[model samples]
Target: MTSPSQEEDDVEEWRVLYQETFGYRRPLFHPEHAVFQFQPDPKFPGHQRNNNRERREENDVDEEEDVEEWNPWKESYEQLSRGVHVMNSFEQFVGAADIQCFDHIDEALKFLDENPEGHHEKLIFLHEGTHNVNHTIRIASDVQIIGASSSEDIAASVILTGRHATILEIQEGARSPYLGWITVKYEVDTEHEAEMALIMEVDAPPPPEPNSSGAVADNDDDDDLEKVNEIESDQTTNCAMVVTGRGVEPIIESCHFQSGNADHHTVVVKDHAAPKIKNSKFIGGSGGGIIITHQAAGYYDTCEFAQNLRSGIRVQFQANPYFYKCAVHHQGEVGVFILDDGLGHFQNCDIFSNAKFGVELTSPNANPTITECEIHHGELGGICVHEEATGQFLKNRVHNNAFLAVWICGGANPILRQNEIFDGKHGGILVHRYGKGLIEDNEIYGNVLAGIFVETGAQPWIRNNHIHSGKQAGVYFYDNGSGILEGNEINGNTLTGVQIRTGANPRILKNRIWNNDNGVLIHEGGQGCLEENTVFDNTTTNVFIQTEATPTVRKNKIFGSRETGILITDGGKGTIEDNEIFDNGQAGVMILSEATPIIQLNRVHGNRSAGIEVSSKGECVVRENRVFRNRFGGIMIASGSNVADSSLNQVYDNLDRVSKAIDRGHCLFSVSGKEFYPMHNFYRCITCNSSDRNGICQSCIKVCHKGHTVMFLRCDRFYCDCGADHLERSCCLRQS
Candidate 1:
């Protein structure tokens, strides 16, 4: 009845004494060499015993306590024993053959060559710690290769160190080959760069044939010849990942791929191969992380691509890749580059910190849908849809990029909605080179330039966005760019809130434009419709129209401006109608520099200067405006060739009804005794007492009518006698 520790010490002393007497040490038993045996526990007869004997001693000491206590090590051991027994039963059920174990690449290849077709549906284990498989290893159909846990357990997994080559390839007709827990590393020379570390080549489907002609050939063999040609064309062709006549999809899971060569790709799936990769990591590749091209498709889940020299994932030539919960970051180029008619759908992905654009969709007809993604902090831009590429960017946080957050160019149309694009070096969104799309409900602000810039004939519908706090205009449309800007809050910009210049004609409607240099500036011949926009509290004019730009300004609440509410200058002409232009520092509507704007039906009041001012060389049609309550004249018509067709306007309640400044002897009208009279005579008395009165001189008012009640009169022509309205009786002479 010895204690376990005391017995262990006695046995160790005896073993050392025996070893010293024999002049040798006992051989150590390795875990791999020792057979795993299971024995039933006494306390729980059905359950297997744990390898640790002290647990059995403890159970014997307190049986009741042991029955209730939970031992994690015992539980794990029992579970592993049951798993091994179940596996043995399953082996019997499937008539499992012996699993082939290889210590070297040549041994594995030799075994595969010996049992080429016979080893179908069998399992192979690689035991090599690390094998530099310089040549490509083609996996057969229904064969699965499982690597050891670590490089020490099996020599390390396959490493493709060859130049201009791939390590492992599933050739044509190799259906459903499973590759698990494999590591592929590349160290190719730069002179002979490799294409891909691992490539899966499959046969592409044949193209659809055209319809046959109705005309029957004289030879009956013509039909047979055509059938033969069709069969020949339908035959499988050789390409990368050639999966010809295969039913099961090739899968590579739990694998790590790395490369350093400039032209090497971590993995390439081409020629219609559809591979599913899960829980894979691609790191430090000089080429790209993964490339699916030539109509090849892939489904990647829970994958990470980091620090690649090229794009993290590149799909081209009609290749379609769907990624879920993937992180593609710190790449040299774009995180995801879809081009050449390639289509990709990425969901719940993080694509950021790339050298170029985070996600770039280029080439004609290439469309990618990126939803619920955070694309930010790239060197160039966030997302680029160019060269006729069309895509949908929904609920993406694209910000803090070098240039534009979302750049659409070269006739591309991308729908950007619910994206927060801000804190960038340049604009938030740039649509140029005929790019057109719907930019709706996005927070585009905090950029160096405009929040949304449309140039070079690009026409994008920008609506319901908060485009504010920008260095330049909130929405700038130049170089013939035009779009529908509706329901946007464009404010707090350093320059104009919405600037349409250089012949751009953007329809601006219902936008809150405030706290900018100019609320809406239409200059350089830009033409558009500014309607129902609340443009106020601007540092300069609320709505500035200059340089021959003509925009129809209607129904806009333009007030609280530092300058004129609506300044039309420099030959600008448009219909200014029904706008509440008031509370400005200068004239509410200033028409200057030969500008002829049709100002009609506007409530121009509460201004510091004239309600509507027409300066020298300015000729405008000002009519039907309620111009009142201004600090200066209601309507100021300057001298020196300024002409304003001011009519039917309620120009009253101002400092002056009309302030007409006259210089020199070019008399416009004669004002005398609180009335404006037309001057048609210089020397004759236009106002006389009798009808047959002689031509009284200008001195008659002072000499003849001395101490008499003399009334002032407005005469139409220079006549000798005055009318009865001005005189007490009719004149003696008949005045014509």
Candidate 2:
């Protein structure tokens, strides 16, 4: 049994022996490999390369472990196994079907130009060495130019260095010509005569043949010539490769492209040309790595771009390209930039470590879709869609960014859905500067700032997202930000679940907000509609409204608070109506500090303290509410505070009926405050009341039952029936 390292040494020795015999480095192979066209040399006689070697059992080792080490010429081995004849050198070659060999590339091209009738598919192999040309080589037929490199580095071994305006041009009418395993480098100063290293354009076709009348017919050939001249004489420079001409499609694989100067891009595809580029690398370019514009499109797979001066890839001018599994990193600017009506789709790509945003889209006409990509470690944000751009970002994992993971600003209206955005230094998503977005179904957490932040007059519709475990608020609206927040689950934040301040007015509806310091905090003149929400189990209060905040809290279920269900303080004023407030550690509704709210139609019960407590100069209109089943007294009003018009309130079934005892057996409207105490008279309408708890105060008697039959009562059990359904007419006191 041979050691693995010894076997590798033996293979290398055999390769060297074959190289000496064939005048070219040969690939060592096992019997199971592809068939190779190995020509016999007179000096080798009857000795066969494979037959002379000791064979090994296939089951002795795993195929992957026994595989050869990766080398630049490995692809050539596969090609050879496919029955491609390997030439010893460019000058000495045997022929195969549609396969041609030439000592110089120019000669081979000249032959194709001379005899262009028969061969639609041709394979031309270039020897592994530098091929210098003064003029551009144009291909107008379906041909494949493959490099036969035997060196450790394919690109370095099969180099194409040129100082011409263009190195290789695939003209119009060419059908998917392939260029593989080669390096194309521009050598001239970019500021000079060189316009591009490679250009594909439509050239003038052969003039129409003479007809029977012995005259050439007029056609669009002249127009074609003019277009060609325009492209050749264009003043714009510094693009290493250009793919132009409508409907032109080419294949470029396993190639390395380098620019001439700091202002040269590696490739530019425009004018609707579509190319298929695979397993290539664009590195250290002064300009962008690739530019797709002018309605051009391309499919790039398993490519790499790094250290570019501009964006790794830029798409504009209605171009729509697809990038699959590409690695774009270490860029001087954004990893990918789409603007100027650009549209692209990126999937399964790793974009990170860029100087700016990993992916950026701008302009009103820019719309792209990015999916299933891992975008991280950006110097700035992971993705930015601004300047009125629109895009769809779905199912991406964007994390560890220096700023917000995704920023939608400047009137942009992108859709961000089903993405996992977390662990950023800033917020997960930001909509600012009048931006608008539809952000939904995303899992955003572990950010230093808010999970989703809308500020500076931006309005974004946020829904159905799981935002939790953040250092700051789950959702923040500031500086006049306004939007609709619905169907989101926000919890476990270090700060408030929803923080609305600084004049922000957001409609929060149908959301479950819990397990935060404060479930909802509306302060600093903030105002909005908080409706149809479930706010519970907060560390502090379920809802805190303070500092002149005036929000409409309606149709919500607020319960299970660590403290009060709803805390209104510091001049807070709002309409808290139609809510189910219960099971709080403290008062169901606590009001203080001159805060005035309209507390109406709420079912306040099951609290450790009073169902509704107003103190410290607080004033409110407590009307048409059912206050019951509380541990403390119902509707407790302190000395300096008052319920301005306590009408139609059924305050009953409390552990302590102290508020009813303090009412002095008078109607709630009359005993709620000092101002209303003068009207202490109580009455009962025989037609409306069937029990001692059904009665009316003097204010309600004079205003609500003006024409109904009534009877005087001592108010032994004081309650109001004016707002209930027992009356023939609506109560005037309750209406007011």
Candidate 3:
């Protein structure tokens, strides 16, 4: 075991280290600037041995014994001598004032109240013991109370215990009283407190009635009588510390607070009081860690809240606080709860391992800016913005929650930007139930469900996001969800990159979708406009429309698919127009299963199979498209399916199947790019003088015959004379 002298040296070293870490030169009202003096306790005579050694050397009167006097000012403990100090035992470093020892905190408080020798400047040091106080101790001045021992070990230091009462109430006008290095635990005697509240209500009188004149009569006696039945309805009583009133800004640093009352808070700050609390730990409290309400605002830095029965911090009723670098975890409820117009700025906070959501914002006006925080390991979710709450969440890392990392619902409209929301049990972000928000510039990936799941009438503007690398779709719209998905990189998901179903209609515009099972899948009555998207390199078809989905596939660059570029099957009906569909393993456009669609104005090329295929009784109007460079044939129609109007299409340069189409009685003029819908005007080559076995349309007479021309056939049937086989001149429209 170490000697007493050695223990004193260790405590001195600790005090010096603490000051070097947190000391700053400021006003006397600030705890960081409070000066502490290391005075020896008269009971501990071993501390004065250095002084005795100096006297002994002076009496020796030798050359070596005449050394200079020991100077405490030049010692290594100079930092502790200048600012706040941490002490090990009760008598390590007493303050500059008279060293007054008190066995009970109540007695010391009474002494300071009655002495009145500038109590604001006095420092009352509580010894290392648990002092029980039955009532609250109210501080009316700028007194400084610090406990002996390090704040890290609160139970081994000075402890103040109270039963169903406010342990410390720094009342109004108590400017900058510093409370540090102590543990305050308030116990709730629930049965007794309930009975007392009942008795107070029974003895209270009714409130006074309004005057007939609609004005209060200025009577002092009536005002005094009316004060008899005043009970605080805000539930701010029976806390470990209640700092109230305007301008009562105390410094609470390195303190531990615990409240056993589950319905109340450990620290309650209300009525415009703004305190500076730093480096404290609110641990294992049955109640919430702190409540800042009724316009109370404070600055909390580097504080830790863990194992609380309720939320770690509750900010409501227009309270606006600032929290920086705080760790709030292991709470029974949410880590942070902001409601009822509560406003706060949270930065660099780590909120994790909560029973419910890590951070929950509710009510219409609960708007707070949370940035650069890590919120993870929540039992329910990471962050929830509900009940029409609006806030800005920027650059936060939210992951590994039980459900979605962020949930925006119930008409909430929060801006989620530059956040990495991933690795959850469900989706990364969920916007549903009529929620409207701007989710832009966020990296949402590695989720079990969709990266962003929008459903149930929610319409958010999702732009400029990297929604990728998920187990399911990148962006899933379901059950009437409508949103604008623009300028996003949706790729590398195990399922479809974008999935729309069940009447969900999202305007998918200007997105780069690749490397998924399918680029965009619309099924089960889904209806949306897929416009201006570059969808390529998917494992399956680039776009799949089936099961009665009538989505408008327009103006998209759909290519580089393992299967067909666009697949319309299973009774699906849509307008596929103005799209560049190419470079697919199968046909560019595959229509089957009785589906009726308008395939018009598309450039279909570079496919391994036919450019456009109609099979399985599908009926489509194929018009005004450029079908070229396909491996099989340009446009192929199976026996059962039929094209309602295969007209005005430029179908050329397709090899191997043109003769098959001709043998099946298809228009030979279509191969030379001159066929159209059944026209009443046809032309015969009168200059060549051939028999009109198959009459050509007016386009063929103008381009193929030119000046050598022909007489108008005036035939109503769809016919072309280019396949007569007895014509002397070759067909000029065909590529020689």
The most accurate candidate by TM-score is 3
For 1-736, candidate 3 gives per-residue lDDT tens digits of 3455664665555444533332321111222434333333222235344664666666874434434433232232333332222233345434443334455666666666677654233556554567788889898777777665434464346788889578999879787887876788899887987886786789875556669978765544442122434644347778899998888888887788999988788989888988888888888888899989989998999999999999999999899999999999999999999999999999999999999999999999999999999999999999999999998999999999999899999999999999999999988989999998999999998999999999999999999999999999999999999989999999999999999999999999999999999999999999999899999999998999999999998999999998889999998988999999999977899988988889999999998777888876888899999999886678877655779768679999876344554445444555433322222345677787755555665555665677975776443334455533335655554433
Q: After superposition, which runs of candidate 2 have C-alpha atoms over 4 Å from their true positions?
A: 1-104, 117-121, 188-237, 657-736
TM-score for each predicted model, relative to the true structure = 0.68, 0.74, 0.76
Off by over 4 Å in 1: 1-100, 105-128, 142-144, 150-164, 171-177, 189-251, 631-633, 653-736
Tens-digit per-residue lDDT, 1-736, candidate 1: 4444554554455444432221112211112211212232223211213323456576565433423233332332222221100111122122112333344555555555566567322444443245565465666555555443223312134333343346667655666666655677766555432222121122333544555875544543442122332332111111112232223366666667776656546777777777777777887887788877777776888899999998898888787778998999999888999998898889889888999999999888798789998888888999999998998899888888988898898989888989888988988998999999899999988999889889898999999999999988899999999989999998899998999888898899998988898988898989999999899999988988888898899999989988779888888888999999888877788877888889999998898767877764777788889998986568766554345557679977875422331222212222121122212222234344443233222333444444554444322223222222245533222132
lDDT of each: 0.67, 0.77, 0.79
Residues 480-542 of candidate 2: C-alpha lDDT, one tens digit per residue: 999999999999999999999989999999999999999999999999999999999998999
Q: Backbone collision count in every prediction?
A: 24, 1, 5
TM-score of 3: 0.76
List ranges where model 3 is wrong by over 4 Å. Answer: 1-98, 106-120, 150-156, 194-234, 657-736
Model 3: lDDT of residue 594: 86
